[model samples]
Target chain A: MATIGIILFTLVVTLAVMLGKCQKKPLSNACASFAFNTEMNNLQGYLLPQECEGYVAGYVNSGQYHSDFAVAIEAARTYLNTIEADQDGKDLIVLDIDETALSNMPYYVDHHYGVETFNGETWNAWVNNASAPALDAMLSLYTDFRAQNWSFAFITGRSKSQYNKTAQNLYDTGYTGWKTLVLRLPDEENLTADEYKSKHRKRLEEEGYRIKSCLGDQWSDCSGESAGKRTFKLPNPMYYIY
Target chain B: MATIGIILFTLVVTLAVMLGKCQKKPLSNACASFAFNTEMNNLQGYLLPQECEGYVAGYVNSGQYHSDFAVAIEAARTYLNTIEADQDGKDLIVLDIDETALSNMPYYVDHHYGVETFNGETWNAWVNNASAPALDAMLSLYTDFRAQNWSFAFITGRSKSQYNKTAQNLYDTGYTGWKTLVLRLPDEENLTADEYKSKHRKRLEEEGYRIKSCLGDQWSDCSGESAGKRTFKLPNPMYYIY
Candidate 1:
């Protein structure tokens, strides 16, 4: 009787779980709300005006604001392919790391308790905290570009020593799929972030990569907007370099 | 009051489900009883003899089988670095599709159901099905290798017409995150799968890729065997070529 009872219990439990999962309102959809800690921190128009040009409004109507980034990514892909490829047949899209590919808004809002800026030490601390999520538009853009054989390169102001940490952090933060993720190094030290970035972007082009497009919250990501390519901007009013 | 009641009911159900998940075994622990479906229709050493010896096993696991395939991926700084360069500056480890990186065992086993031989049309049906999981050891191997800077190149047996289907299937079935994926093309029709694969592999070598390792479940994957590179080998006893 005990053995029979055990079997019956298992059957009931399995069925219940499966049935629950199939239901439209599955139990505990509560934590579907479990977005990144930095998801909600982008108010105050801290993002720059040039980056702001990309916002077509109603970006987050589904409450996720998927389109703002989706349109941007699709627009970038359409525009990016025309750039000539070097011998290697790669189309490069330069991207920034912070609120660009990932959302640091929640950390700033909650952990720093409304602080609007960053330093290396604090930024490193947050990444090590490993609590961010890939921003929607960026994730979509990365996947779409990859599907089309275009490459997305992350050229960030994050210091060089944190390369592994940053990479691992990105993976942990659900930015796992991108392959060409580059970080800033101190040989990048004396150079302003923009200067180092411009040099590297040119190097990437010279090395046979057709850098078709550039995306970022910072001017440095676009080589300080000096490249001849067409640029699509996103609004990052929450934070920008003067 | 109704909303409060709903919340309370949800909390009770949540506790029950949490208990269930906690009691449930880890995904890793669920392997043994997991029945597989190999897509290939052959069960009686289904691959051709040379296909087994010279093609699948040879190039698929040629050279060193240590974690290099997974290790080399860690060196990828960006998609460009992953595709073009490496840390020690060697871009190696060209991966094979089918049983090398992904387990086609389940799909293969199904096509051979109640029989002990290989059949082509049934294999085609399975290819149409294109459902297989990345085996656990290989997944762990890949994740670890990607951490070690061993860049990966995926070459598969499905023809070019099957590229979109194959890639989507891989993405759906979890054989994803590869930087470079190549498909088998049946269009030319003049060359055998073996000759076709060898030429492509040679082309890569000619392009300056210092391939440190090759992996696949068929001899054609290691078409380098005649060249004496003797690529790595992994066991596939459930399906063999007579």
Candidate 2:
């Protein structure tokens, strides 16, 4: 009877182990766990397009994307009205370059959402093309902010060499009047986008500008000390940057 | 009769859910899910010292730490011999400070493995003390490398301000004769450790040094472009740096 009971326990344990494996998550035991379906979900709070290409593509290709941005615009308009800008303190909005202001959907679509790994050469080529379309929601928000007399600072992790192309791209996409355009210097290439952006915001503050709203798709955009009074995080589960 | 059957089924499901929660291993659904647990595990490989106080203390207090170091030394020696280094290409090893060469375990112990978050003032005080013990394994490996005529370059995320204290600590802890000590400049404070280290490694390459092996306790230590011929990652789950 004892032996039979032991045999039953073994069978149950084996079944449990098999069930665990079938849950469709990445195995953290291996070194290649980064960009795995599970790691992307845990760290980025969304699924990669590679994992569900159809769903993400469908969401972005449809009117649903427009609806989501509309809601964000509503919130931004309310916040902009709440704060009163005076001559003593110049009101400013800090914006991220990628995904937040511009859509890299074409690049992501070609690469399978980083499933094939991010190739720098190809990405640089895409940046040079400067054909990325404006995210309508962010573009709308930018117009509203401009109407309210708020100045803008565009901070990006793009290399300093790409400054001209990026500026042209923004202009072509209808970003008319940003007061400052901060690009990552070659020496500052080691800084994470978050760290790089935070420093730029601090520099603006030192120069006597008050950041009323900071907007980005990644948590790193709105995180760290000296963050603005309001932060709006748009949805981008497609990719994450440290 | 139908209501009673439905109640019984609900009770059984609840019991199963409770049992799943009580399991010893991490739940894929829970906060300590496999990927999060894996990230923590990868960072603090096999060391629960921060999360579980007594377990880490018990592991380090025992001869287990030394044994683990011995295993690492063995791996390093085998890899060192396997690679061919010549006079044409000066063989170099990149070393990271803090937990890679000298341990901050004492500080972690005092603070309960940073359960209270990293306090810079207290950590600076500890750095000022400069009494951190050398990892017997890494120290032994260093001696072996020196014997083989391979030069050493110490590149760390430590600020330039901490150079004197860090150098003193290394000397007191038995590290002697390194080619260069690269400290993070004040302007480079915003750079992620990985980016800073990668740039330093790249600079060394440009200056005609061939990095044979790079060792650190974090993935950022081994990742990015211009990484060494080989990378060795030591276990460090106490804290994470972006």
Instruction: Report every candidate's CA lDDT.
Output: 0.52, 0.69
What tens-digit string does per-residue lDDT give for candidate 2 at B1-242? 45545554555555456556544342112212212333322222233334455544543565444444455455556678887667553788888888788889888888875456667899889988989999888888887777777888898888899999999999888789888889999999998887899999999988988888887766677566666655665655356666
Model 1, range B78-108, lDDT digits (tens) per residue?
2223343368634656666766666665664
Interface RMSD of predicted model 1 = 21.5
Q: What lDDT score is found at residue A202 in candidate 2?
A: 89
Best by DockQ: 2
Evaluated on the second chain alone, the candidates' TM-scores are 0.56, 0.78
Every model's TM-score: 0.35, 0.43
lDDT of 2 by residue, A141-236 (tens): 788778777888888888999999999999999999889889999888988777888888888989988888887766577655556765665556
**Maximum-lDDT candidate:** 2
TM-score of chain A of each: 0.63, 0.77
* DockQ, all models: 0.01, 0.03
Candidate 2: stretches off by over 4 Å: A1-242, B1-51, B62-66
**Clashes per candidate (backbone, < 3 Å):** 66, 3
Candidate 1 segments whose C-alpha is farther than 4 A from its true place? A1-67, A81-87, A111-120, A173-179, A225-228, B1-242
